[model samples]
Target: MLEISRRGQAMPVSPFRKLAPYAELARQQGRIVYPLNIGQPDIETPPAALAAVRNADIRVLGYSHGAGTESYRHRLAAYYQRAGLPVVMEDIIVTTGGSEAILFALLTCLNPGDEIIIPEPFYGTYTAFSIAAGVNIVPVTARIDNGFALPPLANFERALTPRTRAILICNPSNPTGYVYRRAELESILGLCKAHSLYLISDEAYREFCYDAPYVSALELAGAEPNVVVVDTISKRYSACGARVGALVTLNKQVYVAAFRFAQMRVSPPGLGMLLAEAAAELPESYFDESKAEYQARRDLTVARLQAMPGVVCPRPGGAFYVLAHLPVDNTEAFGQWLLESFSYENQTLLLSPANGFYQTPGLGSQEVRLAYVINRTDLAAALDCLERALLAYPGRTEPPLTTTEVASAFTAPLLTQLQ
Candidate 1:
């Protein structure tokens, strides 16, 4: 008989990947599905990065250094310096991706039963990585009404047990796409220092802010000795396939500890490093243009969603997602209904239920995450389908009134009348 480890039994499959079969079915049915569920961008990778690979003169595709090619690391350090996340080559460990960097960070920093605190409506992969590394993920809830900002310092402080080892923050958060403000980041930095906790800041979408300014955890250098910054070129370079990222830190002890895990793996992708090095050298203007395009898509998506009945979507400052609170009883069911039952003009929208992102069960049952990863024309149609589905879909609760007469659903009646 085959047996699995206790961790394997207790661990859940990734919620995002589970939807693949259904998405495939829809594609085969010839339904034009707008992928609002994942962050795989449709943007073009810069020619410089692509050219670096095509023009490479490799003879034998040999494994590079375990920590990645020195030239690549050195160039990466310089790139971070330009982005305000100053680092030295020795302080950076180029991993397979931000995902591997996270796993390594957890494995190196935490032992079994040790905990890492994360906010609710987080990136789903974080949960899986924590479990794989035998670390408990303690989630603190952040409200959608408040634009998914960091929970108050007191909330994090209260969740802290003696076994708490680190606080993980995903800036310009996934799913919700809300960017962290300077003051909020400062508050959390103070708490990390006070509690002597390692702050693992995941800045994967550092350049995606569309509203409020972004604050880097690395910027809090003089405050503490436990800050570990995790970053990747996946989203930045529109190179999800690149599989190149880094674990950066100024904390010498933590860096040494993390490096041990790096040594265990022979090396990360070699060809990917060549592309990543060129990506690191991509001109600043490339990012400026990409950010502008994402901002336009976000603006169109939010405005259209806000017009729909029973939907409350806040404009995100960064990232390419919008966490929308819908009128349905369960977002999980609503997501299925969108793909399985309803379509408008032969088009349907694929959404990720907000429940998976929320660690607290039943809390985000009425919410769904919409990734504005498509062009404006496609996004408009997707929003239209969502509006039609909201009206037609049958759920447990009475649907919110989304009639043309009512422009705003959440506002007080008096306010609506005044407007």
Candidate 2:
């Protein structure tokens, strides 16, 4: 029998879908499961984008240029410029999804033994991508008490080594929903310049910032060669199935290398590109309405989590996610229990345990990342189920902490363990 490659064997299971079997069992047993695990939003896709695909007069669904359709690239560049990222057609290479763009960035910038430093409790897929590329990830842990803000500069500096080749960040981060402020970005930019490292900014949730303004790495004055932005239409336009995303940068060498890899993949999705182009043309009001809806959901989520006994969740500044530290020993086990044993009013909620988001062992065991992507009614129902589950969980250990105790315990320099 042939042995599997070490890289293949080491790929981390998706935190979002790891409990899918339990969810399936619950469904089979006639329970209505409100899925708060994944980041799939309940928002409707733009009518214009759907209509573009419907009205396409394609005689053949032929392969497009490897770098994506030229017309679409031009339009996308303009879209980026409007969003405060000065880009041109030569700076963009459209790909299947933000996932592919990330893989391409890792493949293009670093060799097998090279290392990339990233903030911990990151998007889980980054770990899988690094494994596939045979690269190492050095994580700098960020505290939830501070709303998972960018870890200190000294932490990042301490993590850097001779083999470090890049620094990756997810703005309006996926699980934490902590938006990097302009000052924070500038500090990272300065370090990247000093270290000659590539900065991979995943801006998939760029348009959903609530409390603070988003500052793109591309907007920085001297970040041209160091910044490679990974963007997708999945969360932005509610077009996840379309699988359209792009790698945008002013670094000519990186773009050339990524384009070569793009050729290997043949072409991006055809209909997806059409939808993306249509999405680019949408009025500013589209984003305004969508942002308002997500902000409302975020407010509701944080409020509910705070009201729960032993739960301590910081209000997120952006994105539609919150990482809540629960009063449990292991969230992985608690998540399974939620699906396998718990329900309220014939309803239960599915959640992604926060452990998988951390690369460091023994971190994030007591937390869960909740995506506020559902409607208010469903979100309210899900919160009710979660609160009731905590009350009835067999492993329940402690009472909820006050805001001050929560802050001091979760935000302090040293990692805190529940008493």
Best by TM-score: 2
Deviating ranges (above 4 Å) for candidate 2: 399-419
Clash totals in order:
4, 1
lDDT of 2 by residue, 56-78 (tens): 99999999999899989998998
- Tell me the tens digit of each residue's lDDT in model 1 across 1-419: 99998878877766555566677788789898888888888899888889999999988998778888999999999988887765889889999999989998898778988999998889988888887998989999998788888888889989999999999989989878878888887888888888888889899999888666667888764643877888999999999999999998888887888888888888889888999999888777878888998988887887777876668898788889889888888888877777777776788878888778878767778888888887777777777777767766778366444555334431222211100
Which sections of candidate 1 miss by over 4 Å? 221-224, 399-419
lDDT: which candidate is best? 2
**Reference-based TM-score, model 1:** 0.93
Q: Candidate 1: what lDDT?
A: 0.82
Per-prediction TM-score: 0.93, 0.95
Worst 10 residues of 2 by lDDT: 410-419
Clashing pairs in 1: 208-318, 209-318, 210-317, 211-317
